[model samples]
Target: MQDNLYDCPEYPLLLILSGPSGVGKDTVARMLIERRPDSFYFVVTATTRPPRDNERDGLDYFFVNFDEFAHMIETNELLEYAIVYNDYKGIPKQQIRDALASGRDVILRVDVQGAATVRHLIPNAISVFLTTRTEGGLVRRLHQRKQDTQEGMALRTATARQEMKRLAEFDYCVVNPEGRPEVAVERVLSIIDAAHCRTHQEPVRL
Candidate 1:
């Protein structure tokens, strides 16, 4: 019926790209979407945290107040949500459903805790854990960010160390070295390609 194996239709994928705070999850997510804009849909997360000077409300994150976030939770509109570094963040359900319905691979950039919750909810979703090449590298990145106060930075560093121990929970561990995010993006693309070619692919349950 088909001309060749390449002609077979492939199912869309739900990919969770997660890591500790400073491992470049956002960078890698942006690169993936840039590389496959038509086939990939990046899920913008909604957060109760105040936006930074350079961040936009709908583009970088759906910046919401505590009341709005609570409303979303009450209405069961979020797919998975968690408090991170004293701020609430969540993935919206309808945007993901719409993207998957349109056959675009959905990508979610979340922290390690949120990733675990999403994996439990969507067992068939592919989860990738991103980390720097060395623990010291991660620490340096966290320190260099300077977005947080000294106490806040200390807390984030401690939390990141704890999150690193969660590497086993993910399907793949990617080393996103500093300033070389493109390499990590290439590896992620390869993973997506391999997933599409699996002989016994499990339909993502969402």
Candidate 2:
């Protein structure tokens, strides 16, 4: 029985990537998945927001009109959903179910609030919080974005300060240095690898 504990079978892990508004969570998630293409199921989030210049409808997010997104909410089809910057962002339950059922780890990139919600929904999920090296760096990154208005940027920066205090709720934290996404990706990859090596793992609920 003692030896059996060490022989635990590998199960598909549910890895969540979350962070402050301007912390590059999307960039790090994309890089990490591309690093190990065969090992992850990236859950594409559904959003009612318009697609950006470099964003693809289905790839970056399943861009839909408000009615379509609202329907998903009405049907309880989303794992988690939120109103962000006047836009609806959510994760589809079906994608995560299909991915885990097929024996692949799942990755979800969400904001800090969504992360906390996911923790309750999936207690065993391996949640990692990513942030910049300093507050000044984070503020600069937010300011550099083109689409957000001055008011919107100020709101995000304020929310980020509140979100930072919740880091203790996560399993691990990685600071992504300015302009250094590779470093963040490597840190997150290592955390996932370590989780799989644990003798007792939390079973992902969703």
Off by over 4 Å in 1: 1-9
Q: C-alpha displacement of 166 in model 1, angstroms? A: 0.6
lDDT of each: 0.92, 0.89
Model 1 lDDT per residue over 1-206, tens place: 86675545578999999999999998899999999999999999999999989888898999999999999999999998988888999999999999989999999999999999999999889999999989899999998888999999999999999999999999999999789899999999999999998766665665
- TM per prediction: 0.95, 0.94
Which candidate number maximizes TM-score? Answer: 1
For residues 56-122, write the lDDT of model 2, one tens digit per residue.
9888999999999989999999999999888999999999999888888999999988888898998
Off by over 4 Å in 2: 1-6
Model 1 scores a C-alpha lDDT of 0.92
Provide the global lDDT of candidate 2 against the true structure: 0.89
